[model samples]
Target: MVRAGFLLSIFLSMALVPASARASDPDPWFGHDKFLHFSVSNGLAAGGYAVSSLFWEGRTERLIAGGSFSLALGAAKELYDMTGRGDPSWRDFTWDVIGTATGLALAWGIDELFFRSDARKPVEAAATPGGLAIRW
Candidate 1:
């Protein structure tokens, strides 16, 4: 719960930056490029979570891995843009963060809803007439 509140606060602050501060910015928040950033970040985050699940057993570790992977890629993109290939926009990064959070939340919720029970159930083995049967 504390983590959720903290994340919410960060998101709100990023989203609510004053209009006056962005008055001279060329990039619009609702631009098509922003959409791409959001979508790519979302996909990357979910993919990272799925990949990390193969290595990590804990939910928190998986979430961190996924979120960090997405954010690192976003930052790398921004850094590349800073090298004169394209315009670097904080708005794009903000969208990336939002998308990452959304993707992580959806993936985590799906995991909890669909996979939690299976993980929690204990495995049992019983001896049959011919062999041993294993069940979870």
Candidate 2:
């Protein structure tokens, strides 16, 4: 399915990291790479959760699937970097995890705010002459 292909693409991208740096002295962007990683990974995680929710039922399942995808992707990227000219920083991975948490919160908030299922609505009960009647 599309999810499988998407995951494969992510893994392929990680595998494509160059062994050597093509440019001299990559910019860290005012030493804010950690922040960038945090925010970007957070967004990626949220997006993954949102997408997974479309295919998976139940909040817990969606959260687990999306979170696992995000974490695996982040770890894979870091591991790939370690093999290249780029040094793998645990600090970056920490930020990625924080970002994933933020993303889950965001996804949950959005689901609660806009995508709540009506199936959870309470059923109504009416007293009848013989017994109680339930209405959904």
Candidate 3:
């Protein structure tokens, strides 16, 4: 379904990283720059979700908005790097994707736990002559 397609697209995008970028990346996966990319992307994704929530009622829509916003910025940064301003590294983009997913999941969890208006209402219980009756 839609989930399968989404996952496939993610994997395909990762696979599409240019060979030149991969070959020229002298950066370590655990470098400080990678940490920065991860943290910043995480924050951006969460913030995007938070902002999108004000206008969208659907969880899927919010998630898409947040993820797309974060990933677009990550792609933009890599494209900028490719323009000779900095070293372009697909590893950085990979960290960005990981961070974006983490942030979106965290935000979705928080929204479900605390902000969901469609959550079930509290059950009511009444004592009957023979037993307790509950109404949802």
lDDT of 1 by residue, 37-126 (tens): 999999899889989999998989999999999999999999999999989989999999999999999899989988894558887878
Pairs of residues clashing in candidate 1 = none
Residue 115, model 1, lDDT: 82
TM-score: which is higher, 1 or 3? 3
> Residue 117 lDDT in model 3?
63
Please report the TM-score between candidate 1 and the true structure.
0.68
Which residue pairs in candidate 2 collide?
none
Tens digit of lDDT per residue, candidate 3, span 1-136? 9999999999988888764366653688999999999999999999999999999999999999999999999999999999999999999999999999999999999998998666467767786678867677
Instruction: Give each model a TM-score.
Output: 0.68, 0.67, 0.71
Those runs of model 3 whose alpha carbons end farther than 4 Å from true positions after fitting are 1-25, 122-134
Q: Mind giving the per-residue lDDT tens digits that candidate 2 earns over 42-136?
A: 98888888899889878888788768888898999899999986778887888889889999889988987887877778878787778868677
- C-alpha displacement of 32 in model 1, angstroms? 0.6
Model 2 CA lDDT for position 60: 83
> Which whole-number lDDT from 0 to 100 does residue 94 have in model 1?
99
- Candidate closest to the true structure, highest TM-score: 3
